[model samples]
Target: MTDLLFQAFIAAGGTAGFCIIFRVPLREIPICAIIGAAGWILYNVVLLTGDDNKVFATFLAAALVGLLSEIAARIFKEPTTLFTVPGVLSLVPGFHIFKAMEAVMDNNMDSSESWVTITFKLAAAIALGLLAIGAIFNAAHAIFNKTKHVTTDMMGTLKNMTTPPGKK
Candidate 1:
């Protein structure tokens, strides 16, 4: 448990640093940090479970973080893309991508295959992450639009009551 917590802290810190380095909005930094921490925790859990479905786990983690990020964006009235980018940075599979490219450059077929597998896993993770973000943003937008319409109607009614009808 302690290890997990430490890892989470590290991931969050790293994410926050990245955001700061890139001059991301201060308001969005914490959200990105929290999401990063959660993603790392999920990654560690999946790794420890010794399950064969590692790819699935990675995908689920990414999706969850992405959804959370979208929700945060809605709450803060900022662009979800900004938050999601930093939030999901921790799960970008940088090592896998690098290894795959390296293998190809070296002409090592077996290594290349292994690296390709990693690439596929990373791709699935990214896809799942995107799906979650899209779903959450769509739902949030629908709800927000409905609420806005209701509020606008109510305000119009109040204005009508206060104003004398047919005033020039």
Candidate 2:
């Protein structure tokens, strides 16, 4: 739909702006923008299922962003935060913060409390999602490097065994 495209465009632009403000590499700006757009789109799609669980939607979106950021970090040899920090900007509950402030200004304690609770939940979901992906990738990387070292050591031992004793 046109609306979805428009939202994606907005998210990308916001992400690009964030990169610009933070002085991210020029070459990385577009990649960060795409990551942000993808995350926002995914959040929207998940919400469309009518589950009404914005926290879960945010968690999934942040996880997707984390996954993409890790892949991009490997391919580009840049820090994952360079991609992930900007990529998650779109999912931040800015509207909820505004609503909470407005409720406070109007002396509506109940509404303000509800908005604050939801905002905190959404923020936690994002953090947990990113943490989950980072742990998985780090564990995998460690396992892979361990295996590579073992294989290299085995190759060296095999070479030593095949040589004649007088060769030294």
Computed on alpha carbons, the lDDT of every model, listed in order, comes to 0.80, 0.91
- Residue-wise C-alpha lDDT for candidate 1, range 1-168, written one tens digit per residue: 999999999999999999998788887788789988988788789888887766777787788788777778768888877877777788777888889999999999999999989888787877776786688678877687553323226446543242356757
Instruction: Write out the backbone clash pairs for model 2.
Output: none
lDDT of 2 at 52: 87
RMSD of each: 6.8, 7.0
TM-score of each: 0.76, 0.85
Clashes of 2: 0
Question: TM-score of predicted model 1?
Answer: 0.76
lDDT of 2 by residue, 1-168 (tens): 898899899999999999999999999999999999999999998988888889999999999999999999999999999999999989999999899899989999999999989989999999998999999999999787663333226446543242345654
Model 2 TM? 0.85
Best by lDDT: 2
Off by over 4 Å in 2: 147-168
